[model samples]
Each structure stands twice: as structure tokens, then as C-alpha cells.
Target: MSDSNTTDFTNPSTFILLGIPGLERAHVWISIPFCTMYTIAILGNFTILFTVKTDLSLHGPMYYFLCMLAITDLVVSTSILPKMLAIYWFNSREIDFSACLTQMYFIHCFSVMESGIFVAMALDRYVAICDPLRHSTILTNSVVAKIGLAVMLRSSLLALPFPFLASQWPYCRTNIIPQQYCIHMAMVKLACTDTRASSYYGLFVVFCVIGLDVFFIAVSYTQILRAIFSLSTKDARLKTFGTCSSHLCAILAFYIPCLFSALTHRFGHNVPLHFHVLIANVYLLMPPMLNPIIYGVRTKQIRDRLLRLFTHKGT
Candidate 1:
């Protein structure tokens, strides 16, 4: 190994995360809402998991996929948020290179998993609305299980190379990552080596997973709209629309900030660094907290179950 004393391209022993850069004086105030969101995300997602797992009436394929979504959101949120809170609260922003890489791996891995599950949920909605008679037969337990396994495998295998390729480069430069958590490009950009390949692969992964998923979702919704229009009664169409609004909100909450963040990062050179960092946190933090609440309040069955749980406790 090169001398640590030299300014050569040597890998860092530890990286200091500069959370929300110029907002150092306000980290205390910022932590209030972040802490609340984290707590709500944890508690809300657990409630969904528990409600779905224990309720016999929710044993359908739709609820099963919902449970899977809750699990994914839970894992992703847990992996990213606590560390962010630590940075905000205690100034605990130092992270080892290997540990940082590990965090990056899981963040990318679970993000892809979350996207895959979104596609799966879209497919479920498609089948249920477009082909009601076959929905049950098509999305049986075995089929859902098989699809879940494929989703997990695809994300895990594809995202495996991100951290590996990032770690391949030597990091002789300063070790201050200007974000709350270790992200793919942010960490990779610190290397004093060629990172064009990492950038290209990041885009490739985005297209392969989220791009493809969004296309299929659009097709599914097209068919769904046709199916809804074919119905004679307005009430039927309205009811059908209501069943899907929650998922639509969930999708927007997940993807809109993500797309915006990516765009600003690539092209918004004049954009403030604090804005970029805020958006990164929004996309990662908002979806997990919002999803469960969206489903719990919007879906009548889950709402009823939640009410029953609270009512029983009250009694």
C-alpha cells in the first residue's frame, strides 16, 4: 500500500458524511420531522405486515402482493433512515469504506427490489381488473411465490456489481461524501479513476428495471381503462377507479422524487446542493412512510382491520 502520508490515489479508511451541507446549524430542527417519519414508517409498515399476515380474509393474491410491498418498503426504509437520523442528531457521519460500500450495496439492492415489487403489484392490478375471472387462477400462491423469487433474484444479482465496481477504484482524494448516506454515483465519483463505466451501468440498470416496469404498468393501465369503460354503469367505473387510486399515489410517491433527483443530479448544475440532498432524502424516506398509510386508509379491508385492532384495544 502507498504511504498514507502521500496525496496519491489511496483508498480512504473512513468517509465523513456531510449531511445537508450548509444546514449544519439546523440539523437539530431537521431531525424532528425525520425522526417522526422514521417512527411512523416503522410502525405503519409493521402494522400492514401484521394485518395482512394474520387476517384470514386478506389471504388473496392482492393482499399478498401488498404484504410483499410493505416488506420491501420496510427493509429499504430501515436500511437508509436511521443512519440519516444519526447524522442529523449526533453528528455521527463517519463511515468506513467497506461499511459504506456495504450500505450502498443494500441501498441499491433493496431499491431495485422495491421497483420490482411495484411492477409486480401493477401486474396484479392489471390481472384483477382486466381479467377478473382469471385473476384468482392466474395469481395463485405458487405463481406469486415464483414471481417474488424472480424479482428478488434479479435485483440481488444485478445490483451485486455496483459496490464491487465502486470499490475497484482507488480513493486517494478527500473522503467526504456530501450526503447523508452512501449512494452509488456519489461514492464512485470520489475515485481518482475512470468512472464512465459505472455511470453507464447505472443508467442501464435504471432502464432495465424501472423503465421496463413503467412501460408495463402503462400497458396494464391502458387495458384497465378499456375494461372500466366497457362497463355499462358509472358506479362500477367509479368503484373500479377507487380501488386503484391508492396504488397510483404510491407509485407517484416512489417514482416522482426519484426521477427528479436523478435529473437534477445529472443536469441541474446550478441547482443548490442542499436541494439535491433534500430530494435524495425525500425519495428514500417518503415512500416508505406514505405507502402504508395510503393503503391502510384507502383500502377498506385494511382500514377495517386497523380500526378493529384499535377498537379491540380500546375495549
Candidate 2:
């Protein structure tokens, strides 16, 4: 171990990741669930991608947005799970500085992309239910592509400063990160220099990305509700609402855990470190695992297609 008080102001070549910190004894046992969730996440997301790609019935704006969500989920989960599993299973906790920064970048970047996709999906739902006549024309292939490109650019640009800022700091402090992966704040806290700029910028990005996304989603849903309630028949309202059930489930699955993790990290001072670690892991893994199942169960078209697929394979 390098001396913590060394005079060197240069960044460390490698950082030690203490997976789950205080629960080191339970690392092996804990890895079982993480590994399971990761496997399920991978298979579930790929299934969504393949099912959408091959099915002509699903070739719509909504399904295209779903494909984007699945891809984002895959990237988000893949960015952190392998390294986290390694820490738990083999005790391989040393991460190269540049690799750590890259992991941090992907994890955060795709997460924002995921949030943006949810907002797009919400708007797609709003248009579908509220303006069924113009839905097809409004969210055309060109428009969808543009939205995708914009989301990618927004996420990439917003996330760039996290790693860039981290790289500039001199890590005279210990390079031991308490979490399983290199979180932005975790890495920033290791710097010997002041990190308020990074901290405030992080807050800015959170409110700018997540807060704005949430507001838009709420507005979209509000409009959707007004449209639904304006319908004359109860059956019509129920039918319309059922279409949005899957999306609502997905949004809750993502944002709830995400907010919990962030709040716990920033404000839950009384919370145990292991609990924080576990919630953080859950925040990353849960959405990827749940999204496909949520859609499969709630969406009649997808459910029917999946059933046909399984029955065909069984024959």
C-alpha cells in the first residue's frame, strides 16, 4: 500500500475498490444475487431488442423507443456489473485509473440517456393516446432518429465533465474508493484539491437532467390523464389507461430506486454503508431486470409474440 501522506500530488495509477465496504465478509454470498440479476438483465434486454427488431407488428415509434431503452439498460448494467462481480468473487478490486474513469463515464452517460428515453416514451404515449391521428406523422422515423441523436448528445456532453474534471484533480489523498465502482462523488472525494465545482456541477446535472425529465414526464402524463378523463365511457378510459401501464411501471422501476440511492448517498447520514451499497447496486440492476418483464406482462402484443416464440421453439 502506498503511504497515504506521500508528498506526491500526482494521480494514483490504480485505485482499490472496497466492494460493499463494511460487508466484506458477505461478499461471496452477496455476489450470488448480483450475478443472477446481471444474467437476467442481459437476457431480458436482448430479448426486448430481438423481439422488437424481428416483429413487424412492433415496428412503431413506441417500440423503437423501447429498443433505445433496452440498449441503454444493457449499457448501464454492463458498465458496472462485471467489475463489481469481480470484486466480490475473486477479490480483484484494483481498477486502473483510466479504466475507472471510463466505467464512471459509461455508467452515468447511459443512465441519463435512459432517463431521456423515458421522457421520450412518455411523450410517445401522450401523443398516441391524446392525438392518435397525428401520432404516426409526428413521431416519424426521421423525428425518432433525431430524438435519439439528441438524447445521445445530451447524455454524452453532460457526462463528459465528470470524468474530465476527475482526471484533472491531483489525488494526493488515498485512492481507495469505498464503493464497488467509481462513482463521480466517490472519485472526486479522493482529490486533495477543492471539489466544490465538481460537486455543484453534479448537482446541476442532476437537476438539469433528472429534474427536467421528471417535470416533462409529469406534464405529459397530466395531459394524458386529461385526455383519458375527457372520454365519455368508463370502458374507453380503462382501455386507454391500460396502454400506459407498462410505461408507468418502467418509470417507477427506474426513478424510485435511483432517487433512493441518490438521496441515501447525499442525505441519509444515518444509513448504514452496506445498505447504501446494496441500494446502489439495486438501482443499477433492478430496472434492467424488471423492464422486459414489465413490458412482456403488460403489453398484449409483446406477450403474444413471446408466447408464439416459445411455443414455436417448443415444437
Candidate 3:
């Protein structure tokens, strides 16, 4: 029903995210490995979730944080993996504008929430290790619940500006996004108008949120180390350190990649696309993939529960 000129002038309302352009010929080859990774990530995190939920022994603050982390991993992986698979397998890369926005919103929201949760977990560890007697009273169910709510609220509120800024930009005729997923920066770059305001605002938000979270986490861990060193008995120090080891590993894995990505985007924009894509994937996939394993290997109670469950199923 439209005229030829009108049709020619109007950009398509949807975008086909052809991932890593030249890699199209390798899609099938990459898909096999990618799909395998996705399955493992899902199953691994799901097992952690199930084990924690079913085992009453894990009802304390540590497992409570683990379960929340598993949920965040599930949400983050689900947000991007299915879409990536579809693009690689069926060549169905099309994503509507609204759907893209939704994906971007949730991805940022959950990521920020995860950062806050990590900080909370660090605090919980510090309290448990540095002040064991008061651990129970300090991180009670009501207190943790309140902290969880604050995490969700803060993440949602902080990430709200990104989508709002993105929505204001008019899309150009050339709308091919270069990555597998709907990243906010990529979307903003595709806009027809000048993006200085949005870019600066986003940079400010990223630094403020991630920077403060990391700072608090670092401070908490420093005090924990001091407390550990102060203990005269080697056994006491080892036990306390062991309890926090998994969380420390997970935190390092999650935050380093995120900080690197943010730094590259801010200061290393001149870097090659391949480097960018690699770091982005690390930011997107590494946390989800490593979270379950970190928790499983580090936490004895949850690990035992998972082993028993699997053993029973095998029989």
C-alpha cells in the first residue's frame, strides 16, 4: 500500500544482528561449541539453584546469596544465549526494536543487581569471618531481604536512564548492529543524531555504580584478610579463608571482565572489533558460566547435596 519512494526512505523497523560479519561461513562450526556451552551453563546453574532450594542446610545467608546469584546467571544467559543460538543455527537474526530495548534493559538491570549482590555477599563474608558471634544477628533474614530489595531497586533505577536515552535517538537507514546481542552502546552508536549527551551520561553512570561497588568489595575483603591474619590458630584462619575463597574467585571473574569492557569502551575505542567482541563475550558469558562452578566447588554443603542428587539420579 505504500509508494516506492516512501518505502525506500523508511528504514526497516527491525534489525538482523549478523554476528561478527565475516564469521558467517563459520556459523555452523561455531554453533556446535556455542550450544554446548549454553547447555552446560544452564544445567550447571540450575543444579545450583535446585540444590540450594531443596536442601534446608543451605538456608543461611551464604546459600541465600548463592541462590540469588544462580537466578541472576539464569536470567542473564537466557537473555542472550537463545538469541545467539537462533542467529547461528537458523540464520534468524531479526530482532524488533521493542524487543531489543527490553533485552538491553533487563541485561543492564540484572548486571547491576548482580554487582550489588556481590558486594552484599562480601559484607556477609566479612561479618561471618571477622565477627562470627554477631553474624546471625547482623545478617538476619529480614535484613538480607531488605538488602535484596535495595539491590533490585537501585539497579533498576540506575539502568533506567540508558533505555530512556536510547529511546530518544532516531535510527539511521543503516541499522545493522555488529554483535550477537543488543548491547546498549552499539544501539546508541547506530542512532542518526549526535550521541555526546547520552554517551557521557552512560559513562558517568557506569563509573559511579561499578566503581563504588568494587571499592566497597575491596574494603570488605581487606578487613577480612586482617581478621584472618589476626587469628593465632592456622586451622581457624584456613576455615575462614576457605569459606570466602569461592566468593572471592567469582567476584574476580565477574568484575574484572566488566571493568575491562567498560574501560575499553571508554578509552580503547580505537581497538579492533575482534578484541571488543572477545571482551564483550567474556563480560556476557564468563560470570554465568563460572558462578555455579565457583559456588559448587567452594561451598561444601551445597556441593555434597548436588553430588548426592546426581548420584541418586544416576542409579
| C-alpha RMSD of each candidate structure in angstroms | 1.9, 2.0, 2.5
- Candidate 1 TM-score over all chains jointly: 0.96
Whole-model Cα lDDT of every candidate shown, in order = 0.87, 0.92, 0.84
lDDT per residue, candidate 2, 62-165, as tens digits? 99999999999999999999999899889999999999999999988998999999999999999999999999999999999999999999999999999999
**Residue-wise C-alpha lDDT for candidate 3, range 1-315, written one tens digit per residue:** 655554231244677687756778887887776677677779989988888788888888888887788888888889988898888888888898778888889889999989999998998999998888999999999999998899989989988887787777777556688888887788776887888888887787678888899999999999999999899999988988998899989999998999889889778968887578668877978888888888888888877898898899999
Candidate 3, position 309, lDDT: 89
Q: Which is the winner by lDDT between candidate 2 and candidate 3?
A: 2
- Model 3 misplaced regions, further than 4 Å: 1-12
Model 3 Cα shift for residue 130 (angstroms): 1.3
lDDT order, best first, reads: 2, 1, 3
- On lDDT, the candidate that comes out on top is 2
For residue 237, give model 2's deviation from the true position in Å.
1.0
The CA lDDT at 144 in model 1 is 96
**Local lDDT at 48 for model 3:** 86
Enumerate clash totals for all models, in the order shown: 1, 0, 0
Global fold similarity of model 2 (TM-score): 0.97
